[model samples]
Target: MYKSQRELKKDAVRAFLKDCKEGRFDGAYVFSGEEDYLKEHYFGLFKKYFLGPGDDQFALTVFDDMSFVLEDFLDELDNVSFAMSNRILLLKDVDTRKLKGEPRKQLLDALAAVPQGTAVVFYYDSAYLAGDDAARRARQSEITALGKSARLLEFSRQDARELVGWIRRHFEAEGKRIDDQTANYLILVTDADMVALNNEIEKLALYVEGPDVSREDIDEVASRSTGVNIFEITDCILSRNYDRTLRLLTACRLNREEPTVILYHIGVMFSELLYVALAAARGITSVDTVAADFGVKANRKFILRRYFNAVSTLNVDFLKQCIGLISEADRNLKKSRLNKWTELEMLIARMISAQIRK
Candidate 1:
């Protein structure tokens, strides 16, 4: 079996946790990746290790991209804590690559010059990393310089199996138990964001009367994400349930989802369906292979079943037609003055009509 990105990061996370437990000190560290929950969880561990049963509130200083001052940050690094613990400086979501010219050089040099007794952490939120192409390129370019002076660690999202296991463990800790199918259902409805998942888990644990959790309970209590709603919308279209499709789309609008955003996800769903159809025609039936080839996140491979099933009934030509309709709607959204919801409903109507004519 091929090693996944999460599997590759496991050793690093283990080592880091061990170092924190053992009080191993590094001058500077960089935390960046898609898994925000791990970053925060491990940071809590590190804080406990460093602070240790004392009121050492002054030992740690935090700064964000907007609030960071190079001189002030350097000053904090230079100062040793009187409380006998190492001083720690945290820089949150500050990508040094965007600094430009001399400021960028100064920041890199400062990272290298971090005193032995002080530790600096640069945390990159997934939101920042998920930015436009230009920002991503800058992030890539900064890694070389950042790597020279700091230990770089990435906390990637877990695979589906791992996440399901994690969900079970969380419920077990809360004195409740959830089966795999219900766990997966929760994942489907809530999307894969761990912080959000944690919140929902707490809600379910409190809301459930018995020890066991059910899918019906999840349907009753857990909040649905727009991504899941998009999936449902696609499923409705595929099933030729025009009324439910329009109702769901209207619900999305009421929830304040933009037409462009909804249209974008619809376009992506159709595109992926087209890719799966092409792969099927080429005699590739392995879900794992197709998902890996399509660059689907490991945690989201469970979604491949829906895509494959949808593609089984959909010809490439129809999928292409759906994509074309999406493109035209996108153009209309940009230039035409038709009510946004009406354009979207018309798009759905046309997609369903195409399927009927088939």
Candidate 2:
């Protein structure tokens, strides 16, 4: 139900803080996601917003195991907030498969009877919901029953374009500037993780002069010569020049990098490109819409604006082949028997290079 990551985090925090500030936060939450820092950041946000950055504090109980009984949750829920403040029962994901008939039924029944003046929040992996029939069913049931009383906040991952802008925002805040190539290079290296990318950019910027960051500056100032190498490989692939691709591949291997990581990055890039190319061939005018259709939710708007020209180059067939090659390479790259570098090299040369339009 939630569209973007920012919206989910902001809206959820705001609502919880409002309730906590009003002495109303109660019941349980299923907080989920693979991003450990963000998860912990949210916990801090809950503390700050509810605890008022001052004298009052929220009481929180955490349950992290599948064997946790239904009464464990209710017992905490029944407890009043310490001195007129909010209380949070944080339920980490439970193993639904492990639950037998009565336990499963009891869990569902417990969900149905969460106390009034209490809110139940679920933080979970975005992918986890697909297999979770009970969670999906519970949410659907809530929409019909709880009205505004229940809230579902979703945190989504950033698409490419927004991720780029996020990189730019970091540089801007640090009183630094970088060209498109440098910025994209940095993002590619960090795998679009804003926090890591920003930190790396700051380190790079610190090595340079005031307010002007560039590719040359990055090359000169980088201490380890390891950042954004993935972007360099991507640049070669996008240029559609086999020599460049080969050259970059050699450079990466010479640097003592993990061969599988290279293969994985290439696989991701080509897959994203294929998404655009196929969508364009199908008459989707905007990457934003296409991203939604394909569930490629990262940096979509930024990707459309910046990379549309490149994406529009490939025909649907090209995208299909490219995706197939990437898939095969992905499976092969991790194999114990194959030389990862060689397999990746063949994929780039045979599959990706063959798909080059110009």
Each model's backbone clash number: 0, 15
Write model 2 residue lDDT over 1-358, tens digit each, in one string: 7456566565775786677567665444444433443555665676565545564324555566554666776566666432365555565554444556887666656666676544455445434444345876664443323223334443445556556677787788888877666776555556555556556777876787768787666556543333345555655666667788787778888888887667665666666677777666777778667667777645434544444677765566766677787788778766648687788788877665665653
Which numbered prediction scores highest in TM-score against the true structure?
A: 1
What is the Å distance of residue 33 in model 1 from its true position?
Answer: 1.3
Pairs that collide in candidate 1 are none
- Considering summed lDDT, which 10 consecutive residues are worst modelled in model 2? 142-151
Best by lDDT: 1
Put down candidate 1 lDDT per residue, 125-212, tens digits, no spaces. Answer: 7887765569787785675468677887888877678889999999999999999888888888877778888999999999999999
TM agreement with the true structure for every prediction: 0.92, 0.64
Give the whole-model CA lDDT for all candidates, comma-separated: 0.83, 0.60
